[model samples]
Target: MTKKNLLLTILATSVIAVFAIIALMPFFFLFISSFKAGSEMIRNGLQFKFDFQNYNLANYALIKTERDGIYLKWYLNSIIIMIIQVGAGLFFSSLVGYGLAKYKFRGRNIIFILVLMVMMVPVEILILPLYKEINSFKMIDTYAGVVLPFIVPATGIFFFRQFCSGLPTEIMESGRIDGCSEFGIFFKLMMPIMLPAYGAMTILLAMGSWNSMVWPMIVLRTSEMQTLPIGLQSLLTPYGNNYDLLLSGAVMSVIPIMIIFLLNQKTFIAGMSAGSVKG
Candidate 1:
């Protein structure tokens, strides 16, 4: 390669590496801190220096014994919520997006415009009404209350719609010629072709659901039903802090999202970029 091109490549790589490290620094700190005692953390604060002598698996072990292993319950709850939200989100959001993109019907543009408008509104602003609505339906303190309200997120709909718009409709027509039902065409034919989009959305939806704290916090009343984030935050009280449990639990909470992203990293870039371009 030319020296100029090589130099540019090196510069870009160096910049990206720096940014990646910057992003990962917090996680690294959290991982290391998890091994420390609560007193040590409070005394020392977060430090760059790793004293191997102070590190131990005690904090992790405490997770199993603390409050009769309540941490595990929180983890399980988060997993359940994440799966439901991601699965239902993708299914319903993609179907709506697909219909909006592929079908020429009355008020289609208006509906798509409304989706865009919803995307602009912050969830915080709608929380009051959402809570009231969920409460009215007697879904409060239930998983349904948390998951149902956002099962088909506007962001997901917008993403899937944009991606579907870029796809060719020829395959859809061919499916009709072969006497395939509309759902069959979408599920059997178009779905496979949209694998990249699915992969990308899967990671995005998983992360959002996994990390969600506010809506779940409001909906879930019982301690056992509380999600990972809420459970982790409960460690910090005005009386004292349980950094031993909190730090370790925080580290564990990140695992699911990291796994999802790693599994879908290959298609994430392609899916995100492809959705922006029109066919």
Candidate 2:
């Protein structure tokens, strides 16, 4: 290679590395600040220090929230919602995606187009209508109300459709010849082979559900039904700042996602990359 070309490559790589660090430095700071005391919040803002023992683990202990405001309840709600969303949404999406990719049927193209249109439709637009519907059904202020709206996502279907498009068609045919029913083929073969897809979809759905604020807030008006994201908002009362509790809650919220991503990072990237290449 030419010397100038080599030098440019090194320079470009260094710049990207610097930028990546700059991007991630805040998360590092956030995690560390979670361990800091109220004084640390006042001193250097979010990026200060590493005094790990500033707060004890017991400080964030599960307490029965006065007037049904338990952090543990909210934590459980978020976790349950995450599981339901990730599990059911991924299941239905993958089934639909595989059917679309493999089956030849009437109005197939039109159906695919409809799926795309659904993806294009914004989530905000449905809030008012959904609210009215939930109100009618009396799901308001319940876990079902908190979770049911999230049971569906066009984005998940679109993503799975894209991923499923790249799989070998003959494998599905082979399953059919082996006396497998369509449902059998999906569970026995397609779902298993699509582990990478599942990992990616799980992370995405979980994070979206876990971080959801507006929809959960709307349907779950009662504090008892609050998810972690909405519950954390309560930590900041009107009168004064509660930085320590806020940061602790933030840490608790962030840790689940952080751990999930770290565990599945490689497969997650592979599945995400599959979208463009496979589609």
Candidate 3:
């Protein structure tokens, strides 16, 4: 290869390597801090050390037994909420998006416009109204309150709509000719076709729902109903701090998201690229 091209290749590789380190630095610190004793962490401030003797599984163990295993309870709550939210969100949001994209119905354009408008409005702004509505239904401090409001996310609807818009209507027409019911066609045919879209949305929605703190903080009044993020924050007390448990719990909290991304990495990338091109 020409020297100019070789130089550019080396430069690009170096830049990427540097940015990768920058991105991973926080995680490295988190892992390292998780291993350090609270006293050592306070003294060293997130530094790497080879003090294996000082590092123990005590923090993790304490987290497990603390307050009747509340950490595990919170983790399970997050997992359950994420599963239900993603399942319901994907089905309802995609169904709405599909109809908006492909069907000719009265008020469809207006509904799509409303979805777009909702997307533009910040969630923080709607929190008050949503909380009031949930309270009116006597759903406060309940899982339903947490999951229901976000089950049909505007962004998910918009994304699926854009993705579905690029899909061929011929498929649907063919299904109709084959005597397939519309719901059957959607579930059997369209869902498989939109797998990549589902993958992308799954990761996004999973991450958001798993890490969601604000809305949950406002809605869930009981400690047992709390998710991981809020549970982690509750580790800190006015009288004393539980840095070791907090740090170790923080490290563990990242595992589910990493697993989700790794599972859907290829499909997620393809979906994102396809969505961008189609959009």
* Clash count of each predicted structure: 0, 0, 0
| Candidates arranged by TM-score, highest first | 1, 3, 2
Candidate 1 lDDT, 181-236, residue by residue in tens: 99998998888777788898999899999988888888899989999999988787
Per-candidate TM-scores read 0.91, 0.81, 0.87
Q: Which regions of candidate 2 are displaced past 4 Å?
A: 1-16, 35-69, 266-279
**Residues 108-152, model 3: lDDT tens digits:** 999999999989988899899999999999999999999988888
- lDDT of model number 3: 0.85
Each candidate: what lDDT? 0.87, 0.75, 0.85
Output the number of the TM-score-best candidate.
1
> TM-score of the candidate numbered 3?
0.87
- Model 1 misses residue 142 by how many Å? 1.6
Which tens-of-lDDT digit does each residue in 6-51 have in candidate 2? 9999999999999999998867776666655545567666654456
In candidate 2, residue 60 scores what lDDT?
Answer: 48
Ranking by lDDT: 1, 3, 2
